[model samples]
Target: MATSYRVGIVGCGSIAQRHTKAYQSVPGFHLAAATEPNTETSRAFQETFAIPKMYADPIEMLQKESLDVVSICTWHGLHAPQTLMAAEHGARAVLCEKPMAVSLDEADQMIAACQASGTKLAIGHQRRFYPGWTEARRLISEGAVGKPTMVTGYVVDGLLNTGSHVIDGMRYVLGDPQPEWVMGAVERKTNRWERDVPIEDCCLGLTNFAGGAQALLQVDLTAYSSADHFTVQGSEGLLMVAPDSLRLISPDNSNGETLPTLWDTHTQSAAGSVGFESYFHIAYTAQAQGLRAWLDGEAGYRSEGTQTRHSVEIMMALYQSVREGEVMRLPLEEGAYPLSAMVAENKLPLRYPEKYDIRDPQRRTWIHREAYDRMRADGLSHPEIMATLFNK
Candidate 1:
């Protein structure tokens, strides 16, 4: 029998509940403790999970518990810092929530700290375990899609918020190729919600792969509902994949009948009844499987930090591309977040009036200097910088 791994969760939000349930389901894993800033939620989570210990602060929980595995399911900005803390506490494995971190530098720091501390760092890109997506990848590798020349996909939400899922899913299906470049555009006029995690109103981007494949992505924050769908095309076959279903189109049908596009449909469902909740179960199972494999020394976690950092970079490059009105290359220069810098540059639409007026002489100079540096770092031309400064 495998030895049990003691687990602790750093956040008590909705996603953390799923992680708690998943920990319980996985053999040789124990959800022993949790931490949350909110007392009411902390108490409730403790009661619900029967976790023996709970703390209002994550660092305190780490200091008190002898935990082997730590799950950081906090906000986008907190992932890196919390993971670093968990690693410092000697966690053998740290599973951080998606989008990795708000900036590339933070992602690098998390990876470095975990590597130095011998902690296995994984990101919460759980769709890697979806059976339909896995099947689609298999068929494509087996030439079902015959080389996968291009992919067109759409996500029903904002770019960094929900589009992270779409981007990571495509990266997985493409066998995790190195991204070459991205040419993109975004609108921040709408999608008034999600201020906590600022995102684009709508986004359209094309990311090219080093292996000569490309993916075109569209995300509309105003979409009716959340969705994950993609149509992959190749020389000989095609594939349509979503969260719950997979359809394959090939020239040589099993029936051997000649048709323009002969599709074979495959539907997926949970072991029990199927519904919206089923997707969460699937995600949790995948997380558990990854944890178990890494613990057993069987393989590296699929959504490991190094791999997820690429997605974060891609997401940032998309915004950088929009800001510069040109394609942005891979391995974006590290510093402040591109999205935040874009907002500072007044490149995206603002929902409300400026809270603080920069008209004060000192503040105006500082703000203008910051904008100039950001635009320069992005490689904007002098004329363009003048236009930005004078246009407003």
Candidate 2:
């Protein structure tokens, strides 16, 4: 008989909705309980998902439920503490969202706690499961694009929220190399803060891998509708990876001798990279698959805690590089929230959203502040607070 794992969700936010739907698609996983600090939101989530139990605190949920897995889909700052609580309370595994934590110290603490309690922790860099990305990795490993030398990704959002995907994606395609150093610069001209974490209007960085490979990251808020492209350059060919598409350009073999040219291109359609295929819900399903594999003692499952920590370390190193105006080395020696420190110092420039079609700046600011205060008072989840402000 197959074992069905009991699952507990820590936050009843927008992401939790996606996770619920994905869990419905996965076999041997039951959505037993959930936690949301806000009363109304928690009730709504419970009703929507048909969750059997709901609580106002995750620790309470952990204490009362015999959950085999706990998904910590909380704010950026709460991931570590909540994960620790979950591990201590006997969760066999935990799935957390990206950016891992705001600082390395917190990330280390989460790793240590999970290790101490024998809990398998997985960060939600589930895009690695996309067929397009996995195929790219396979092709790279197969030497289709011989000796990958450089990689690049263009994104349109904050580092932690959107940029982390690019970083993780690049890492995935490159076979997860050890990062040597990173040099970065950030422009903070916006009031783009996710909960308490500050977001940059534009951030660019170059990360050097141990074996002379390099990855370039360009995240600009101005490119609001950018296609979000990830490309790899190798000694023999070039490959471009997108959500719905994958393109490879290599030598053309035709009449007589074979010759490489720019005119020859091969495109692949990854049907799995479409709507729910490439987006939110499918990712959680992929996560479930990885979890099941690990539980079954399958080899080569990629969501281990150590690898996720490397991704988080790369993120933190980029921020540290931007702040110090120099190349930052890997395995950060110190732990601090560099972005938060910059925000506290008022080092970031105030953005004029009114010029960007956000008219009535005063009223909007007041409303956002009021909503934020409400969230703090009611202990609302991060997604709910964001929804209240943006009317989402």
Candidate 3:
């Protein structure tokens, strides 16, 4: 018989909602409890998902609930401390959202805490389960793109939020190579924050993986806006990957090939992917399932903790490169978040000082969550919803 896992969510944001959706879809996973600071949002989440318990504090939730799996679906600043709390409380496993932590020190702390407590920890880079991505990795490994030389990723939004996925995803598709070094640059002409964490207006990074490929990334580095996609250049052919689609141009094929979106999960699962036909929206389900499998004594969890630290290290190393104004080598010495230090040192100061949070209006907090939810239910797009919220 498959074992049941009691799950608790630490933050009731849209990401948590998605997590709840994923949990409910999979069997033997209970919607046991959740934690959110805002009382109104807490109640809304509980009632909306039929969660059995809700708490005003995360520590309280961890202390009270006999949770087997705790999902850390909070802000970037909160991931490390909350993960530490979950580990201390003896959760069987923890599935933290991406970018793992704000710094290498915090990331290492979370890892050590979980390791000490005998708890399994994994990050929510669930997009690694995307069938297209998995197939791309398989094809690359089999030499479809012979000798992958360069991976160029383009993304918008902040590095920790959206860009982290691109960089990590690039690594995953590129056979998860060891990053030898990185050189990075940042621009912060306007005061900008993403989920209350200081961020750059735009940035670019170049990471050279050990003897394999060089990854070049541009985030929010366009005249007006950038996008989320990556291109792989190799000796034999090229491949382009996006969120919903993948295209390959190889020597064997004159015309480019667009891979199928859906694949046999049973076949893919044997190769460290999802075990079911779950895709995009339910990647959380795949991640949770992988954690469950690991707890059940299975090997080969894709988003395993020690492996994810490399992604965090690469990002932090990029920031450190910018801070030191030189190519920063891997196994970085800096433990603190270089961006914060750089800003504190009055480096990367604002040329236009009107401070703003890129996601301020998008957050569904106690105050303005109603109109946003309503507009969303009415089948409105994000831009449309934002227009209605602003017009109101």
Candidate 3 lDDT over residue span 17-83, tens digit each = 7678777766668878999999989989988999999998888888888888999999888999988
TM-score of each: 0.82, 0.82, 0.86
List residue ranges in candidate 1 displaced over 4 A.
190-195, 221-227, 253-276, 349-392
TM-score between model 2 and native: 0.82
Give one digit per residue, the lDDT tens place, for model 2 in 1-392.
Answer: 23888999988887787677667666778999999988999989988899999998787889889899898888777898998999999888898887788888898999999899989888877777666677788788898778999998876546777787888888888999999988888776545565456666568878998877799887762333223358888887788875445678777421222222221011112113335434444556667777866766676468677787776788788888877778898767758877767767766655433212122243345446665666645755333444455553
Model 3 clashing-pair count: 0
Clashes of each: 0, 0, 0
Q: What is the lDDT of residue 152 in candidate 2?
A: 85
C-alpha lDDT score of every prediction, in listed order: 0.75, 0.73, 0.80
* lDDT string, candidate 1, 1-392, tens digits: 34999999998988898777777766778888898988999989999889998888888888888889999988777888899999999999998888788888898999999999999998887777776676677777788778889887776436666778878888888888999999888766432334255665567889998888898887762233234668788888778876556777777753322223211121122222335677657667667766777978977778899999888888888888888888998878845677777877787755533332212243334237788668756756333443476567
Better by TM-score, candidate 2 or 1: 1
Candidate achieving the largest TM-score:
3
How many clashes does the backbone of model 2 have? 0
Supply candidate 3's per-residue lDDT for 300.
67
Q: Judged by lDDT against the true structure, how good is candidate 1?
A: 0.75
